[model samples]
Target: MTEKRSPWRAIVLVSTISSYIVGGTVGGVFLGLWLGNQFGAKPFFLITFLLFGLATGFYGVYRAIEPFIGDEKKR
Candidate 1:
């Protein structure tokens, strides 16, 4: 038998995932801007850190969902 999951859990998970991605991306952009200004290399740092942030965000999403994936597999 499959157990029913709570709707609140889903809502919380979605919220967490969104926050992780948005926070990482936004934080990266801000940091990149600051660093670029400090080092006088705007374009390079901005692009690099933007990509880094995206990667970090995706990694975070994967990590966050890993437990749920494992639970599904066990069932």
Candidate 2:
């Protein structure tokens, strides 16, 4: 028998997911900015890295939620 998760667990999970996305995007932005400044191509690197970061963030969210998803399927 599976135990039900607490509401606090859900809240914490949501917070974690948001943090992952935000941290990744912010980190990417900073890295892109630095690279752009070094290479004299601000807009290009900024957009490229921004998208990459967003994608990475989503991937992290997927990974974090995968276990819960599996549990639901089992139920």
Best by TM-score: 1
Per-residue lDDT of 5-73 in model 2, one digit per residue for the tens? 778778988998999899889988999999999999999999999999999999999999987886667
After aligning candidate 1 to the native by TM-score, how far in Å is the CA of 23 from where it should be? 0.7
Q: Which sections of candidate 1 miss by over 4 Å? A: 1-4
Could you say which candidate leads in lDDT?
2
Clashing pairs for model 1 are none
Summarize candidate 1's per-residue lDDT along 25-61 as a digit string, tens digits: 9988998999999999999999889889989998999
Per-candidate TM-scores read: 0.88, 0.86
**Each prediction's whole-model lDDT (CA):** 0.88, 0.90
* Backbone clash pairs in model 2 (N, Cα, C under 3 Å; residues 3+ apart or in different chains), count: 0
RMSD per prediction, one decimal? 2.2, 2.1
Distance (Å) between predicted and true CA of 52, model 1? 0.7
| C-alpha-based local distance difference test score of model 1 | 0.88
